[model samples]
Target: MSKTSTPGQIRRLTKAHKMSFAAVATIGAAALAATLVPAGTADAGTTVAAAPVAWTQAVEGVQAKTVQHLSMQSKLATDAAKLEAAVKAKAAAAAAKAKADAEAAAKAKKDREAKAAASRSTVRKPVYANNLDGWIKESLAIMKAHKIPGTYNGLYKNIMRESSGNPRAINNWDINAQNGVPSKGLLQVIKPTFLAYHVPGTPLDQYHPVANIVAAANYAADRYGSIDNVNSAY
Candidate 1:
């Protein structure tokens, strides 16, 4: 025995099958859209990925700024060091110049002192003895040269008796002095007598030892014959 279906029941079953197929097609379309689009551009509110060229340029800008800062710091340090070195060198040079000037001044002072000492030494004079014995000895030499005849003993005795060997002796209380003819020198010879018989080679000063002795000897020779003949003051 074969079974037969009614048209209304068959139509209702076909309609349910078509609805299930339409739901499967909607799911397939959503999956295909997800596969084709990028994840960065998936939604309107999502941020976009940066391009490779833009990222590289930002990194290079940061590096350049850092290098510039470092270079400026290095230049400042070098300049400071150079300034300090220059100041020290200038101070050292000033000290050296001051020392040189001081040494030159000291040398100049020393030279001046040496020259003054030499000048002083050059102008010094010699000293001679001023005594009776020295005067008598000098007179004797002059008398010998002038050919005046008198012995050392005769001259010494007369000088001792007349003025006690004082070359500057004056006989102000004597007979010759009373007559306005004062006797002077070692032998107490009057000025008139000394001038009358003044020796050519002797000093004209009556107080001089050589002049007195020679003049007195010449006068005694002419008046009393010789100095040896006189035993006391004439």
Candidate 2:
């Protein structure tokens, strides 16, 4: 309602008042002067001051800008939180997989070592004493492996009768010795019989107790069903 206001100036001021404070800069200084003074009245004794913005419009504009800024901040915070959660989940999954893989490798190595130990135990030879009982027991075990049937009592009885449990016993006056092959060892098995019926793991020497007993047992089982059946000069 300024007395110097032109219709165009009034329109621009009206538009500026409806907008924010920044919108006032769009109108030129001529429009501002026209709004403050009457047309062609510049020489009159009147004070020139800046235009006052409407308080309600200015407050409303500030409130709307504040709401927009808060909304943008909220959206950015939500996005950042989601990204952080995803990164943590990925890292946790990788750690779990690494732990599982390490455990599996450790278990696999333990199993391999166990299997190798078992194999070595299986392949290692059993030790036996150098006595009548040990030789008989070991020979019986060998006979069982070769499907040759005999008993501890039967082997002991035969060994006692043949060589009195002497591992180095040899019959020089026997028919076998006359033919240039002496009956030797605990069961008095000749060289031909000893070589032919010798179990693979025992020594080839007829003086070896277990070897001699195993050879004699093998021969006896083949000929008389078992060494247990041999009671006399077999």
Q: Name the candidate that leads on lDDT.
A: 2
Clashing pairs in 2: 4-37, 4-38
Tell me the tens digit of each residue's lDDT in model 2 across 1-234: 767878999999887777855556656665765686656656667666645457657988999999999999999999999999999999999999999999999999999999999998886667878678877878878888889899999999988999998888899997889999999999999999999999999898989998999899999989999999999997
lDDT for 184 in candidate 1 is 96
Best by TM-score: 2
lDDT (CA) for every model shown?
A: 0.82, 0.88
Residue 42, model 2, lDDT: 66
lDDT per residue, candidate 1, 1-234, as tens digits?
888889988998899888888988998866665665676676866544444556679989999999999999999999999999999999999999999999999999999999999998895533325676666666666667777677778778888888898889998887898999999998888999999999886789999887887888888878887676778878
In model 2, the Cα lDDT at residue 27 comes to 67
- Cα misplacement distance, residue 121 of candidate 2 (Å): 11
